[model samples]
Target: MTEEKLQDDIGVAAATEASPEEKSLREKFGDQVLSVSAGLDCEVVVLARECIAEACHYLKNTLGFEQIMDLCGVDNSALPGWSDASPRFEVVYNLLSVSKNRRLRLKVGANERDLVDSVTEVWPTANWFEREAFDMYGIIFNHHPDLRRLLTDYGFEGYPLRKDFPLTGRVEMFFDEAQWRCVYRPNQLTERVLVERTWPGVDRG
Candidate 1:
């Protein structure tokens, strides 16, 4: 099928019941983890600012998805993670149910200015992951006991993963006590300095 046709079909499918894998999940988990997108193994996504906490709780307690295998945050400001409403940051939760022997991936998108609910209450391992997400992607985990820089040094300015953040570098300042002077330099922006050369008889006085 043509690209346009395929896109139309996908839209229609989303309007109805998500694909088979997602249909099964809806039948199983009900409204716990909404299947916003579905294809091969079921791509379930939830809005972080809206239903992240509830979804994590259900997946852990009700669904017996005890183990949070991995948690990652992705910056989707450039390309929308989902539909038009997909936000600036996405918190992806990879869960494993040891008893049920199943694996699930839940994606939660948060607006640039909004924060996702913290899952540390359900999974202690989530603490570090959430902190990392906040540190790199700037996706805050609301209600986190402590939120601060992890990889970058304390008092770091911008979110490194953000697209708009400087890729070349940042400005740095230092004091030159030897010359009794202070120096400020923009690490990313530089200009060439030139000196004038004169002949032997040029302006000797």
Candidate 2:
């Protein structure tokens, strides 16, 4: 699609209600969609990870969710950690229903080594979005034509967005003019709290 075609989609209004679509989806894929929660301005559907691609297809083809607005990954390690705290990661997709003027949010849980089905075939723009998620969270996208890092180098070591990845990163890269190529070395930055904490109970008078 060209720029002019894209402009037409932007002018479409967002649908405030998804009751009809929700009913249709719930009836057809009750097992796949775990829950449906609607708010004042938005609706979210928690779906099973194994059937995300199929669910998205139904939404776009039948429910009139014509456009995929955005897709990104989330790291949930900080929220809570336990023996069976849900998956450590989640991939979120935002869809726009131009015809119905509705917006829907889809999310699927992903584990450390699991791969989610690539939605590129359904929405070509998902190509870059899925790559970005994989690059940042190491959440693989199975069957993506070109699944590569979007923001990081080809040989980047770890998923920078993971909560465990140090704020300073695992390695530091610098241009090595001596050898005429960039080089990475063990990160040298360290954490040190320079400010002293003052308790409210301490007498300052």
Candidate 3:
């Protein structure tokens, strides 16, 4: 089918009712399930950070969401309409139920100092994904066996993906002939112009 047709179908499906999985999750977790909403093509569940591991266990073993397609982090501190009371960071998990032909997204809010429970025990693939999240967004994962930098170097200074990170980056690297090794130095940008960004549909005036 065409992309537009697919999107129309998804919109209709979202409008009709909540998915069976969403109902089950709400019924099971109750207060632990913060919110249930429809995404472009899947159901999204926002869970309390404390019970995320428990919810994932139930979703995998009982609900048959057997595969975790992806796991990533988001920094919402500078997002439009973000609330000051809400956590600044979020960890998102995309799960796929092959047998049921459905997808689900799980999100847990986390503060900068809070440690999110690692899901490596539930899904082994989460090991590297969690490490990458830690490396990029500085989100800590509790009980992760080897939570280290996956993409960045050992002495990387700052989380690159955060909204507050510099556009030119924290440091510059070059091969030093005298030292016979690669060396990193502080960024030497002479000038930077801060630009205000406006969203497409939002009116600033």
Candidate 4:
């Protein structure tokens, strides 16, 4: 067979072969999984927020995804060509199965006020990851015991990772020599400019 034809056959086979994790999730959850797609390094599954906790439990207990590798929040609102129909924010979970030598990515969408079910019960490491997400993006993890700021001051006003957050921040902190304590004062910047971002390979002119 020619090289091009051989490549085509390999692509076809890969597209037709469903990963075991995907098959198991589909068999167990049915419609709770909104969609599944191939990501750069692993299969990405988008699940309904209502079923996230249950799905995480199933993945850990049944599918052998024993480790929660990492979890973070994404603010898609400011992305170029982002759709308004989709949720403004998303929580992404990276799971690993050491026994099977496999990895999986799970995503759940949430709006500004939506509360996502915490997976800290499934993986204790998720405690700090959830708190960091909350601190940076204001993504609330429901039932996360001791959900508090993990990276910022307790009195910090806005979510720094949000696209709409000011560049200079709402407040500035300084150490007072006499009091020997950090003092926060309102930002006093008189002028602010919003710079337009340019992406590589995109022609503006």
Candidate 5:
């Protein structure tokens, strides 16, 4: 095959598909399906971290769920007791079927160290989803092609969306004659500098 055709084939393979079985399974699972804010138009399913890869396999091969509309990760670090050792981060997958005009949602949860199994083998679009999740939430997607920062700079430290992250942020930049990049994560706020102090200390005495 030509280069262009090969590229197209790869792209098409990654695309998602919706099917009739999705609708049937959605009804069967009921509330466990985990539909989000979209009343009834959207479909969702929540699954255990260990089962996510398997779930995707089932939805795709058994139910004809060919299209993976979106794959995203959510950080629940704000919740007390959330830790790297326990399942906290959630990975969400959206599936669609063109032939049946139906949609489905799937989810999996994991802790900091836990690596969610890769679905890229099943849905090619999952390649980017897993990358984004790893980039933003620090969740690992095992067996991904390129599991690295997708949006953040190479030197970025921690996940910005985490509740503990400061609003001003701790981004570091070169501010000295040496021009060497250094860590700028400030621990205290008031220690930086006060605006009034720059006005040349008034001689009240």
Candidate 6:
């Protein structure tokens, strides 16, 4: 057999069929799973908020998606049709199975003030990832041991990744020579209009 044929065979064997994975989720969670996107590169399963923790546990132990590769929050507030949608935040989980060379993704939604259960207990490595999501998107993870900001300063005012956050930001930092430290103050950059002229297809009237 040629090298290319061997690689093709490996690719076929490594990825699990999408149907079985979706079927397994249905067997376990029934309608709690909102949707499944199974692609050649990876598979994604979206679960109800209350089912996230339980589904994570099942995937790690039962489905053999042993590693939690990444976790991040998505702010849908500014999406064209999602402005008024409830559960304004979505957290995506990336799971990898090294033994099988397969990958999966899980997503769940959270309302503005609602908190999702923490998966740190299942995957200890999720500690920092969860904190970063909380810091950037302001999505709370319930039962998280330390839910403080991971990337931002001690008193950062707003969630920087949220679409509504000002492009220039709420504050700017500078070193105060007299005080021998840094201080943050309201942004001083003057706002400038980028587009002064109206173009075709635009309703200027």
Candidate 4 wrong stretches, greater than 4 Å = 1-7, 177-180, 189-196, 200-205
Instruction: Find the candidate with the highest TM-score and give its number.
Output: 4
Q: Best candidate per lDDT, number?
A: 4
Span of ten consecutive residues with least summed lDDT in model 3: 190-199
Residue 127's lDDT within candidate 2 is 94
lDDT of 5 by residue, 67-97 (tens): 9988887877666556666567788788887
Taken over the whole model, the C-alpha lDDT of each candidate is 0.72, 0.85, 0.91, 0.92, 0.70, 0.87
Q: Give RMSD to native, each candidate.
A: 13.7, 11.0, 5.3, 2.5, 15.8, 7.1
Model 5 TM-score relative to the real fold? 0.64
Clashes of 5: 14
Residue 164's lDDT within candidate 3 is: 90
How well does candidate 2 match the true structure in TM-score terms?
0.81
Off by over 4 Å in 2: 1-18, 81-83, 192-205
TM-score: model 6 vs. ground truth:
0.82
Clashing pairs in 6: none
Q: Candidate 2 or 6, higher lDDT?
A: 6
Q: What is the TM-score of each candidate against the true structure?
A: 0.66, 0.81, 0.87, 0.89, 0.64, 0.82
Candidate 2 lDDT, tens digit per residue, 1-205?
A: 9998777766543343447767888898888878787755668888989888988899989898989999999988775333345888889999999888889998899898998999988999999999999999999999999988889986888898997888788788999999999999998899565765455577666
After aligning candidate 4 to the native by TM-score, how far in Å is the CA of 40 from where it should be? Answer: 1.1
What pairs collide in candidate 1?
none
Candidates, ranked, lDDT: 4, 3, 6, 2, 1, 5
- Candidate 3: tens digits of C-alpha lDDT, residues 1-205: 9999999999898687877787888888898889888788887899999988888999999999999999999999888889979999999999999989889999999988899999999999989999999999999999999988999877888899998998789789999999999999998986467777777788888
Q: How much is the lDDT of residue 140 in candidate 6?
A: 91
lDDT of 4 by residue, 133-162 (tens): 999999999999999898888678889999
